[model samples]
Target chain A: MTFLRSALVPILAVVLAIASGAIIIELSGLNALEAYKALYDGALADRKGIGRTLEKATPLVMGGLAVAFAFKAGLFNIGGQGQLVIGALFAGAVGYGVTGLPWIIHMPLALFVGGIGGALWGMLAGVLKATRGAHEVITTIMLNFVALNITDWLTSKVWREPGIIVRTPAIESSAEIPRWSQLPTGFALAVAAAFACWYLLERTTFGFEIRSVGLNPEAARYAGISVSRIVILTMFISGMLAALGGAIETQGIVGRYEPGFNAGLGFNGITIALLARTHPLGVIPAALLIGAMEAGGSTMQFKADVDPEITEIIEALMLLFVATPILVRWVLRRRDTSEISVGAHWGDA
Target chain B: MNTLSRYRWWFVTAAFLVAFTLFTAEFQQAQTTAVLAATLRQSTPLVLGALCGILCERSGVINIGIEGQMLGSAFAGFVVASSTGDLLLGVTAGIACGMLMGAFLAFLSVSLRGDQIIAGTVLNIAAIGLTSFFFQTGRSLPSGKTSRIKLGPLADLPILGRVFFSNRPLTYLTLLLVPVIWYALFRTTWGLRTRAVGEHPSAAETVGISVVRVRYMNLILGGGIAGLGGAYLSLEAVGSFERMMTNGKGFVALAVMIFGRWNPIGAWGAALLFGYANAVQTQFQFRGWLADDPQFIGMMPFIVTIVVVAGFVGRARPPASIGQPYSRE
Candidate 1:
């Protein structure tokens, strides 16, 4: 019953969102049901659709983890973009350069390298916040612009495909994540990472320490937790997870580092993290749901003649509903059990 | 004097390094200076956003939706400007749009007691999608075409010209705005209260000051200023409205605000530095210095941000209660 009630909120929200979307479509002079049907069909109706859904979910899982874990430590990590870019770039560099290695060695090497690169990138902001009292939100955001220019330069200059567009050379076959027909190796990795997050966030002392630090850094400090160290480390790990997403996307899905393709994905991770209630384990279902929405975005347009942007509207509505749970609570007549320290009050921290 | 008071030396050294790279690179000095001027002009919108950030944060409101607000203005400004062919009307439309967004965000986060970060992020997403949708939908119509307003050679005068007059009206307004805002922040009575409210609203409120009202007013002003930034981009900088046109400048403005330590002078200084990096990257790339591998060259600003922020340890301080949404309870 508790589980059902917890699940009911989102389910009910989804119904309302869908209904609202249908009404908009009706007003716009289209078959509302047909648009929705196309959406579902595009997301999960068949092999190809499911394949696309997983490909979309692969990076989302990593991105959500980046945001979620940082949320655990009460950090708003806008630098996921920076971390993701460096990680993807480095992973691609290794994947293409390290030839003759077996798949086992090469794949893990690329992933590890990507994760570390992301971690290093994140650490820049973390170190500043810890030492200088600069907000992670501001520092990471600044770093993101820097990362964009850097990655753009790298792709255009060194990583460019011969006489072609600005992107890295494709990874060697050995570095490629194995695909199971329509199922990408990246999807399997995402699933494993999700379970791993579940174990780490809900079942470990480190996770507890991170959460405690997030909840009340002063009290956590009194309890002997190294708050500043934890903040920096938490951000580093959070960034690394996000970077892993980019690396996997490159090696397994996209096969190259392209500019602007991962538009707002990292930033969107914040919305996903909030909707997931900041639980690392909860991010799986949240990411999967959002990933499906993203994957089906194109079909939603083609069937209804509505711009694909309506999907983003629906997503934003979901974020809106989740962010302001009071509205949901009022409709449900539930207590204001909505607050979970979204800001986490860093200056005080 | 404080230990490590040689911060200015670090800036000088960094400046020398970048200048050395720019001079020795294939780019000509005139072109480099021209690019710097262009870059300054490019940074006008970002500077305006940073200014808005400074205002709101001073009054103890974290205006995260500056990005969204900028987008709204950029879109509205471009559409109106393109239609009317009048920059002022476009700017007014942009400001109105930004003000609406700001008012909505403030209402939800500040008045309604909603989560500020969540509200801001949601607003950002909605803005991007909403603006892009309209941009795409309007593409079929004539109103959605990109618009521009270049004062031509007015963007190039003498000493004052390169410093101020060399750009469009937006650039001039942004530069002229710095001292006025600086005065307002430190000299004006309202600015004093604004900072006082952010630092300690309880103390401010204890003495006949209305914390909520001050925050609300500052937010609207800040939002309108950010709207002007958006207008600068669409009408002056790029002279067009692209999908997600503001890119990450709003977020960068947040960083610039922080890097500047919430002061108007600091904001201009940091923005100019960032703008210089941007101008240098383009100039170097065009001149073909490290042309084969100029990608990293473009990334120098981000690297510089990291270095700058890291260098700010024990020094960089934002407005007190900057992110904490004020509740009268």
Candidate 2:
């Protein structure tokens, strides 16, 4: 019973908030039932819609992991956008530009290079935090803009793909990450990445060290762990994960590098990371859920004739509820596994 | 002793590197000077935004919502100035709007001790949505851009007049405000308190400092500065309200704060670095240097911003107690 209650907290919050929003549309003379039905159809009713949701969820999983990894070190890394930008730019560069390589070599090489680019960018912030005591959150955020500007410059100038639309040349057919026929490659990648993150976070010595430092750096230091190095490395890994997401986007969805299309994926990572309670394995479900909301948003907008702003409102309320889970816990008065153990390691770190 | 103390040498290095690159920029345009001036003027909003971040963080508040505050003020400033035709009046309205946002942030993050990041992001989302929905509110007629006023005879002058004072009075004011902000942040007794609170809020309270009060004051003040930046974007630089006039300058300003390493003078240097990038990019475009692929040139600033923040292998230093909400036990 307790486990059920705990597990239901996030689910209940989202369901109720969405219901309330749906009701508001109904009260505003829109057919709430039909609107939700359309949303359902748009998000999951069809194979293609499911594929779209998966495609969206791909980046969220990586972004969530990126943020979750940072959270384990008690660091806020808002630079996922910067990391993602570098990752995407470099990935596209490798994906489309590199030639004369075999299919296997080319595909993995592009993805690996993309992740490395993002990781390097992220590592810079980590090093700053580790050595110079810079706050990663703001530093990363700022770097995001710089990354954006630089990516814009590269795509428009050096990587321009012929006339009009200053994007890169499309990836070669040999380099293309093949889709599962009509199915999305994104979902498979996200699932694999989630397993990788789970193993790294839950079952590894490194994850243990990161969480230990996060909980109490002083104690972790006493235990002879290089706390600063861990902080830096965790953020690097986090960034690498996010970069993988961008690489996947390049390979799976958008085909070529285009500025503004992959917009908000990194920022949305923040939302996904927090929603997952910074849990490693939990990122998968959280990302899928958010992806569902995003995927269904247009349908809800079309059928209900409601503004898409409602989707944002729903997401916000969900965040509010999750962030302030005490309210839900107190109201429901139920015990569960998902209860966020706050005040556990506040000042110690 | 003065040799090590002379930090301007570092500044010189920074400026020289950027200048050398600009010179390397292919085929400088006739309007190169004008573009430089405009770019410097354009960076005013970002500088102001960075200053806001500096103040709030110095006083122990992580103000991620400067982006939202700036946008809110930009929208308000645009509507008011367009209708009123008085830049001063519109700017005042913009500041008030910014202050309101600051107050809310203080109440939530300071008094209520809410998570600063969450509070900020929530505000950002709300600001975007609210502004988008009420976008059509308060228009003189059914339509066109807003009215703008030139500063009159004071606008045309040589040297300091053209480069510094000529463009927009606000642009000049931004430069002047930097020193004042620096002195206030570093030298004054209040400045001491602000730093003390950020470094050790508990210790500050033990010394009879009201941490919450100082944070609240700085929060609102920072908002006002950010508001001024936003107003400059609309009422001065662009002279019209656009959906994303501030663009991601607020975010870039956050970087400048870090690149500057959380100090007033440092912020100025960082802003100049970013401003230099903007100037060079614009100049390159004007000279028809990258006319074939101008879109990529447009991305130079963002790229440079990230690279600069990444800062080789070195790290950036921030205030000791940034991003922590005060909760009295």
Candidate 3:
């Protein structure tokens, strides 16, 4: 009953977003029901659809965990895109540049390298914020552009295959993460990571310190917590999660790191984290739902003659509703008026 | 030394501009006016966006949704102009769309007391999605780009003429707005009240000023300014709409606002610096000076912004009550 009660708001938010999406479709002179039906069919009806949905959800799970972890440390890490790109590049570098290692050794090494690459990027923002009082929001955004320019340069100049396409050379066969009976191995890793995050946040002393800082940094500092250390560490871990998502995409799905192919996978993490109400374990269901919508978008466009961009609209609406539960409550006429825990205010440097 | 350090950014910018002009002259003789003109042209939307931030933040409302507001209005302007073949009408529709988004933001951030950043993120995501969903390719403007108007005798001036006197309607308006907004913010009675509310809403309330009303008004007005910037993109600059064409300008404008220390004139100055950097980059690309890698040059503005934000210049102080929700007892 408690679980159900806790779940009610997210469920309602999703419902409202979908309903509003339907209204938008209707207003656009398209059949809302048909579009939705087609979306459902494309995302979940067949084994192929389920495989695509799971494949899409894998990285989102890692991205969601990344953001949610940082929120616990009272940080908003918006540089997921940069971190992911860097991670993908690093993973690609290791996967292609390294010699003839065994499959088991090479794949793990690439993923680990990718995660560390992301961690370093994430830690850069944390260090700036801790030392110079730069806001993570601004620094992360700047880092994103820096990462993009640097990576684009690398891909086109140094790492480029001798071809017309602007992409890195493909990863070696040993580094490829195989899919078993249509279920990707990366998705399992993502699920295990979610559980690990849940355990760390729920039961560990380090997690307690992080959460304490998030709730009240002043109080945590007075209580002998190193606010700066926690901030840096949390960001490092967050970046690792996001970059791991990118690394996984390189290894499991894309086979090579292309500049435009992985766009928005990082930003979508924000939507997923908010939709899950910032719960570590709640990221899975949220990711799966969004992943399904994304995977089905093209099919909806094809079958219903409706724009696939509607999925993004619905996702945005869901974010708004989830972020402001007060609005949702007012709409639903609920008596309870508690707001969701927003970890940090923008005023925090 | 203190004064020199205080005016460090200014000195650096002036020196860089002079050096860049000389360098360009060395390569392409007599192209200084074109470069300066391009700088002003590129700074138009940036200045407008920064002014929008100034208006909203001065009134204690943190609006990170300037990009969304600009993009939405740009799309609206393009769609209306493309369909109706009326440029003025399209501009009106664009401003209206921006104001509508402003109202939505106000409703979420002010009335609902939600997180301002999240509210802004929603605006951005929704704008991108909605614009793309409705966008159709192959739409053309009825005429051409917004024509440049000559200011009589001023247009006959050597270098300054092309750089300032002769420009499109929106560009001129944007230049004019810098002084107008600076006066309105620092001189007028409304500005006083707005500042009072921004710094201390409770105190403003004690003095019989309605904080909520002031915030709502500023946000709406700011949204209109940003909307004008958006319309400038589609109607004046390109004469066609592209998905996410506002790109990262809105975010860059935030850096400009901070660089200017929240003053309209200062922000315009900062915007011009950014614009100059962009203009020089484009020229370099055209001339193939940095043909080996143009990416590093493109990264300069963003990198500089980070350094400035990290207090390489000086600490930028925001309004006291900025980003906080006010509640009346």
Candidate 4:
């Protein structure tokens, strides 16, 4: 009963979002049913389709987990994009920079290095907030640009492949994450990370401290919790999760670190986290739903003659609906209003 | 002397840099004037966005949705102008779109009591999706861009003429807005109420000022300002619109707003500094100065913003009640 009550809003939000998306499709002179059908067929019709959906879901789960973890500490790590970029670049660097290692060693090494790189980037924002009271929103946004420039420079200059293309050399096969019938090992790792995050947040004393700080920092501090340490550690872990997503993209999917491939993936994490109500376990299903949509986007466009970006519109609408449950409650005639609080106050940590 | 003493090193460094650059053979007076002019042009949108931020934030509403407003307006302005062949109509359309977005933001953040940041994120995402979905590839503008205006005698002044006196309509309006908005914000009754509401909405409500009304008005007004900035980009600067072209200017404008300490004149100065950095970046790219490594040059403005936000330069305090929704009992 409790699970049903908790799940009702998100399910309704998705339905409402898709219904409105249908209207948008009709306005665009396309058949909504056909577009949705195409989307369905492309995402879950066969083994290949199932494989593709899981493949897309892999990074999304990591991204969603990253945002959700930060939300637990009342920190908005908008720099997930920057952290992801740094992670991918570093993973790519390790993948190509080093040679002759065993497959087990090289792949894990690259992934670990990527996560550390992302953690460092995230920790930069955490340090700024912890020490200087700089707002994470602004600093993280700024860091995204910095990460973009730095990565672009590295790819175009220092780590450029032979000629013409502004991309790093392809990673050695030894460093590549193994895939089983279109399911990359990253998806398993994502599920494991989700469970780990759940355990950390629900079962551990440290998780309690993090949640305490998130709920009321003053009280948490009074209770002898080091709010600064929690903030920093949460961001560090969040960055690692986002970076792991980027690393998996490099090792399992993209083969090389090219700018723009991972564009909006980090931002999509925002939508996913909101849709999941920032629950660690819920992020998996939320990610899969978005992943399926993305996997099928090209098919929807091909068959329905509608642009693929309509999915993004639906995603945004879902975010809006999830963020403002009051709107949903009014529509559904529900009385209980849940306060969805995430992020820290502006100009302070 | 006391104030000047605080900034003595700034002046000294400025003078030393000018002297150092003057000796470089590549530096010509004409080229330098051109760069200065470009700097003002580059800062037009940024300054306008900052002013918009100031208005909304001063009313206790955090308008992180400035980027969405700008992008949506830019797209609308370009589409309307290109389709209808009327530049004025396009600007109006742009402003209308921005105002609508502002009202939506007001509805979500004020009436609905949603998370201001998440609402902003939604606006940004929706704007990007909607604009890109509707944007056609081969549209051409029938009317040319808003041309530069010559300020009669001032147009002939040495360097100041090209940099300030001669510019597009929006650039002049932006410059005019600094003092106009400063006076309005500092000397007017409405300004005091807005500040009161931002600092303490309960107190403002106690004083019989409608906190809700003030926030709604300010958000709509700020949205219009951001819309004007969008129009400046498509109709004045490039006379064209590209998907996601407002880029990160809206976010950078927030940084400028903070660095300016939420003051209009200070914001303008901060905008000008960023504009100068952008102007230098463009020069470097054009002249092949850092020919082999342009990315570092591109990163300068963002890096500077981070440093500023980290309080490395100076600390800034936001309004007391910012990012909070007020409830009436």
Best by DockQ: 4
Q: How accurate is candidate 1 locally (lDDT)?
A: 0.78
Give candidate 1 regions above 4 Å deviation: A20-31, A93-106, A145-174, A255-261, A328-339, B1-36, B137-157, B313-315
| Candidate 3 lDDT over residue span B211-251, tens digit each | 88898889888999999999999999999999999987888
Per-residue alpha-carbon lDDT of candidate 4 for residues B1-329, written as tens digits (9 for 90 to 100) = 99899767556745754564344316788867866787788888999899999999998888888988999999999999999999989999999999999999999988987778888888899999999999998897898888889999999999888888988888898899989999999999999999999999999999899998999999998999999999999899988999999988998899889888899987887787778777767667666778777788988888877776675434478888888877797
lDDT tens per residue, model 4, A41-133: 899898888888988998899899999898888888788898999999999999999999999899999999999999989988888888787
Q: Give the TM-score between model 3's chain B and the true chain B.
A: 0.95
Worst 10 residues of 3 chain A by lDDT: A335-344
Model 1 - which docking category? acceptable
lDDT (Cα, 0-100) at A139 in candidate 4: 82
On a 0 to 1 TM-score scale, where does candidate 3 land against the true structure? 0.95
Candidate 3's docking class is: medium
Model 3: what is its DockQ? 0.57
Per-residue error for A87 in candidate 2, Å, reads 4.4
Q: How much lDDT does each candidate structure score?
A: 0.78, 0.75, 0.87, 0.87
Ranking of all candidate structures by their TM-score, best first:
4, 3, 1, 2
Alpha carbon lDDT at B293, candidate 2: 60
Measured over the true interface residues after superposition, the C-alpha RMSD of each candidate is 2.6, 5.0, 2.2, 1.9
lDDT of 3 by residue, A1-349 (tens): 7567767888988998999999999998999999999999999999889989999999899999998899888788888999999998989988998979999899999999999999999999999888887778778888888999998999999999888998889999999899988878899999999999999988999999988888888899999999989989999999999999999999999988988656877679988988887899999999999999988988999999988899999999899878774865665567443433452345565
CAPRI-wise, candidate 4 is medium
User: Model 3, A46: alpha-carbon shift in Å?
Assistant: 1.8
Listed per model, the TM-scores of chain A against the true chain A are 0.95, 0.92, 0.96, 0.95
Q: Is candidate 2 or candidate 4 better by DockQ?
A: 4
TM-score of chain B of each: 0.87, 0.88, 0.95, 0.94
